[model samples]
Target: MQIQDLPYPDPGVPDVRSGSRFLWWLGRNQLGGQIRSMAWGLLHFTAVSAQPFCVGYAVQAVVDRSGTRLALAGGLMALCCVGIAVGDTFLHRAAVTNWITAAARVQQLLARKATQLGSALTRRVAAGEVVAVSTGDVEKIGWFVEAVSRFTAAALTVVLVCVGLVVYQPALGLVVAVGLPVLALAALPLLPRATRRADLQRQKAGRATELASDTVAGLRVLRGIGGEDLFLDRYRRASQDVRHAAVRSARMWSLISAIQVLLPGLLLIAVVWYGVQLAREGRISVGELVTVYSSVMVLTYPLRHFEEIAMAYSFSRPSARRAAGVLSLERSTDTEGSRPADVPSGDLYDPDTGLFAPVGRLTAVVCGDPDAAGRLAERLGGHPAEAGTTSVLLGGVPLDELPLDAARAAVLVQDKDPVLLSGTLRELLDVPASGDVEPRAALAAAQCEDVLEALVQGSLDAEDPLDARITERGRSLSGGQRQRLALARSLITDPEVLVLDEPTSAVDSHTEARIAEGVSRLRTGRTTVVFTSSPLLLDRADRVVLVHEGEVAAVGEHRELVLTEPRYRAVVTRETQDEPASATGPETPSEAAPITAAGTAGATEADDDGAFRGALEEIEETA
Candidate 1:
């Protein structure tokens, strides 16, 4: 396949049985490219091999002073040179095409698998490993694939040269024949040690890459905790380790390279010395001795290819194994048993936890463990990736049974740490419109006006809110700003069910309260399942269900639950039972506000909830 026609319609299932098998599979897939490369390579090497005979004949003709023989030899030399030029040029072209196309195909498959796994990908494999596989590993695999055909042609040339030398002059030919194999085999004994060192180098490099990625991603957090130097020092040590490992690997390969060169140089000297002795004894013609000598020298070029092929296979084997490991990951959800293609219409329910979200109602789930809540939210969205787990059903039908596209379209889950792709704000929000909800309306409901203003402040060119660019993962924005922007994006989707896990965790009480009220108002007739422990958010829910010890502990309105259930009150307040519960209700913002980590430890929900409600009220009044 050509580079431009890459990303095959179906990248096809890879043979992940083993690394060698995967390499073989890649070669089998590109048979035509390999054949073309080999054909041109054969012609190129054949021309190189034929040159010695022509030069030997020319030297004999010059000694005999025969005009016709000299002219004939000159013509033959010119023809061989032309053949060499043609073969060498086209051989390079074919080899490069094979390399690039093979790498492109592997990259496409990796990208497709990454998209299929989604959030589960990082959980299964390290992000740095994935990066390495897609970038450096792919090149190694392609290099091996491209080298195979050249290796074959080179081996063929070596064999043919040995036969011609034996026929032309037996003594010199035997010397060449015996010496070539030894020269090629000389490096084999050291290859095992070299490969081990190379593998160690690759491992250290991957660890360092992962560390660098994590450190850069959490730079803000590290600086906040005054631990930036600590991480930097750790990364420095990792980088040094990688460098040391690379140097060791290079040392082994250098030894092999030295052996390869030294052996061939010794072989060339032997061939010339034997041929000169035979000529002195008159056992062979001067032309025959010269021919054997030239042929032996020509064999060196093809012998080097043996070393190259060995190196390529050693490096690419591990790389292929890594790629295969990634491709072998299956979706946790079983997409079996034929089912309808349309989205099932009804309430969404997770059979595992027995959590039912009624249609057209706002249900709030309060889980003390954030990780558990995230997993539950993922289940509710029809991607129960945990093994041995049942599916989340909608309208009495399993969500996994529905076509993947339809299922995704029906339920939109906004992760706690949602990534905002780098693009203009307008492009970011220009997702598939699921309903009549306008983007601006979703933004207002999310209380992201400050985010828009921040973008303008960050960039002078961002006079237009839609024109503002969001940096990767919205890193340029504050945590709250990123959270609000993500919420707005989800709101704009307007799916049948919106599963939000800690949607307002980063925002303050006032903004969270406004968001809660806006969401309740906006999604009045839609199923909305929110996982949060904030009092402002829970108070606005139609029903609040508290999850404790991995099971539902209580179900009621936020006010009634707090008054009746101590566990529920403690979870929301983040306080011990020894602390007295305030008697104030949801409308009393001072007694019901959500506490921020930066806020006073003694500050009660009663103190902040009232302030949040009053601020919301004043804003509504002003509008």
Candidate 2:
């Protein structure tokens, strides 16, 4: 494959059983490119190898004082130069194309697998390792793939050169035949040590990268808890470890490089000295001795390919293994079967959790364990806790059996901590069209006017909420603001079944109550399941189910459940002592005091004040 033909339509299913197999699979996919590269490489090396013979003939012609022989030698030299130029130029082009295309194909396969695995990817592989493999490891694998053809050509040239020497001068050819193998094999013993150090360096670097990524992602939280310095120190230590490992790896490679240079130098000295003795003894003439000496010098170049090939394979093997490991992970939830595109409308049920979200109703799941709640939320969206653990049935049909796109279209699950991608407010809310909920309605239901106002800060179009840009992961916004914005985005999707996990945990009690009322009003007829412990949201739900010991323990209205189930009360109230405090709670949405125009205006004014001050600060910085 060429560079222009990159990003293969289907990178093909990889043979990821082992690293070697994966590397072989890459080679097999690009067999045509490899052949082209190898052919060019052979031409280039062969042309280069012929230069020594031309020089030898030219010297002999000059010694004989023959004008005709000199002219012919000059002609042969010119031809060799042209061949070298064409071969070298095209060889480089073909080799680079193979390298880039191979890397692109691996990256495509990795990205596709990552999308398929979803959240389960982190569980199967370290986030840091995945990053390393997709970036550094991919380059190393491509390097090996591209080097293979060149290495083959070099080895072939060395063999042919040795054979030519043996035919032209038997004594010198024997010396070269014996010396070249020794030179190539001499570094074999040191390779194991070098490879071990390289693996160690790779491991250390991956850990450091992972730590840096995690530290950056959690920087806001770390600063909030006054743990930024602690994490910084940890990262510093990790960086130091990586540096040490790299130095050790470099030392081993340096030793190998010395061996490569030292052995070739000794072999050159031996060949020239032996050829001089042969000429002195009349075993070979002056022209033949010069040719033998030049041939040995030329052989030195191709001989280095042996060391290069070894190093490339050693490094790429581990990289390919890591890449294969990531590719090997299957989506924990089944993605098989060719089912129909449409799913019937019915309640969503997970047999594993024994929880059912009734159709066209707002159901609240109150689980004491947040982990259990998150797992149940994932299951509701057809992502089981484990592969084939159990089935979540939608309309009495297994969710896993449904086509993946159809299943996803039928349900939307919002995680407890959702990420807002870097983009304008409009782009952030841009999701697949579903029901009637518009961006405005969704933002209102999510109680996110403050968020939009906050995003408008320090902007040229200060009044245009949709045009205001959000930083990566909405890091520029407060925790509450980010949470509300995520809720708004989710609400905008307006899926038939919307599963929310702790959707309003970051918001205040008053705003949470308003959001609960707004969500209930907006999702009047759609099936919505919320996994939360807040009393405000629980009281707003049409029905409440308490999950305990991994299964549905009790099902009833919020008030009856709080009154009857102590576990439910403790979980919803956040403590045993707070259970009685819920007794005098508001009875209905109206009693909870709906979001008033004046209240929203006040919130907007407060947000705008913050935005205005931020704008002034930005202006000062620009000035």
Candidate 3:
């Protein structure tokens, strides 16, 4: 497809059996572009090669004193120059088009794969690897694709030029022909070493990128715990490793480049020296000697393309492999028997843990192990667990058996750490929805009026709060604001089933209670499942399920469980058996106020929870 017709209607199903196969698939799809580029490249190289022959003819015409032949030679020389200019311009244009189109095609394919896999993409592949494939690897693959046609054209021109020279003067022609191959092959031995070094450098750089990504994502927490320097030092070491590997790789490539230059110079020297001897012996004319010299110089230019093609292939091969690896990932629902069907309204059930969220009710899941809670939340949305586990079913139909779009429409899972993409507040909240709830209503339900006020006050343009732009990942806002904003976006979707994991983990107790009531009021008749340990949210749940070691351990109201089950009380209140029973008493709305308003107002729920858990553990040990 042409560059203008970009964003292919269908990028087409790629052959991802291997990296080489994936590259071949891309080439086949863009065969028309490759042919167009090759045609222009051939014209350009042919016109350039003819210039030396025209120059020789002009000199011979001058020696013969023939005005007619001299004029004819001058005309041909000018004609060749025009051809060279036009062909060169068009050739560059075509080659560049090929490069851009190929890169665009790969990017589209990667995007499609990411959308299909969703959060599972990062689970299957490293985040850094995905970023590298999308950014750097794509460019490298395009470079190789674009280089192929030029390399072929240059090779053909070299072959034809050698044939023409041999027909005109066999003695000098044979010398040039044999020397060209030797020069081309001289860098072969060093290529493997260079390629190996390059691969090593790419690996080191990917590791460094991953380390930097992790450190940045948790920079706030690191600073809170005074561990920023430790992470900074680790990243510094990784950066140094990448730098050293890059230097080693560059050193090898430089050696190869030196050999290429030195050998070509030697070949030119030999050709000139032999041609002069042939002229002295009266075997060849002066025009022929000059022609031979200029021809060798012209041939040197095309020879460089050989090294360029080699370098491109070496770099792009690994990139293609990584891209292929990511594209090959399949979701649980991608297998046979999975098709789109109307979803019936019913409860959400995870057979693996025997935990079910009853329809038209708000359910709270309390699990001490955060990891277990996260996994359970994912399963509730049809995301598969380890192998051999039964799929979560909705209304007696396996969620994994339904098509991805249908499944996502039926159930929406907002992870604990939901990301807010950069855009105006309106754009951020503009997602596919049932259109029943207004943005303002969802915002109010999420208790985000304070967030809105702060955003307007901080905005320099005096735009409406909804029109204000949020920084990337909402970095300009506090953790609680980001959390509440994400919650509002989820509430707007108005899905049939909503599963949330620690939705209010970053807010204070007072705000958490308000958010709990807002969520209950907004989702009054819909099935909502929240995974949290907060007492306020737990007390608001229609039914509370306590999961222990990946199974449902207790099922009852939040207060009933706290009064009856010791384990449940310990988990929810962060209390030990040795502590006074009143400490674990059911917390009423009025009694759930902040311990100290001044101290708790500024402390996030996560920090408060961590401290409470730590203190409870210490008490248990002392008792």
Per TM-score, the best of the predicted structures is 3
- Is 2 or 3 the stronger prediction by TM-score? 3
Q: Per-residue lDDT tens digits of candidate 2, residues 1-623?
A: 67787679899999999999999999998899888888998888888888888888888888889889889989988998998899899989988888899999999999888766666677678888898999999999999999998898898898898899899889988998888888888989988888888899899999999999899888888988999999999999999999999999888888888988998789888988888888888888777778888887877777777888899998999999999988888765556545777865689888977899899999999998898788788778876456546878888888887766778778889999888899888888888867588999999999988887777774677578998999988888888899999988888888879999999988887788789989999899999999998777877899999999988999998767765676785686443422121326557654442222112212233343353345334323332
TM-score of 3: 0.91
Compared with the true structure, what per-residue lDDT tens digits does model 3 show for residues 1-623? 77889888998998989878988998898898889888888888888898888888878888888789889888988888888889899889989998999899899999988887777778889998888899999999999999998998899999999999999889999998898889888998888888888888888888888888888878788989999999999999999999999999888888878888998899889988999999899999988887888898888888889889889988888889889999888776673336656755798898988899999999999998998788788878877556878889888888888877788789999998899999889999999999998999999999999999888888888568998889888988889999999999999999999999999999987788789989999999999999998878887899999998888999998767866776787787765434222445535654443442113322344554555555444433332
- Measured by TM-score, how close is model 2 to the native structure? 0.87
What ranking of all candidate models by lDDT puts the best one first? Answer: 3, 1, 2
User: lDDT scores for all predictions?
Assistant: 0.84, 0.83, 0.85
lDDT measured at residue 141 in model 1 versus the true structure, 0 to 100: 97
lDDT, residue 436, candidate 1: 84
Q: Is candidate 1 or candidate 2 better by lDDT?
A: 1
| lDDT of candidate 1 over 1-623, digit per residue (tens) | 87678768977778988888899999999999999999999999999999999999998898889889989999999989998999999999999989998898889889878866667788789989998999999999999999999999999888888888788767788888888888889999888888888788889989988998898888888999999999999999999999999899888888888998898888888877877787899887888877877887787888889989989988998899999999888776554425867777788887777788899999999888888998888878877457777888888988878766778888888989898999999999998767689999999999989988888888877779989898888899888999999999999999999999999999887888789988998898999999998877887889998888767888888767765676876687675555423444355445453442224334565654454345345434433
User: What's the TM-score of each model vs. the native?
Assistant: 0.90, 0.87, 0.91
Count of clashes in candidate 3: 0
Better of 1 and 2 by TM-score: 1
Q: lDDT winner among the candidates?
A: 3
Q: For candidate 1, what is the TM-score?
A: 0.90
Candidate 1: stretches off by over 4 Å: 385-388, 456-463, 579-623
> Candidate 1 lDDT (Cα, whole model)?
0.84
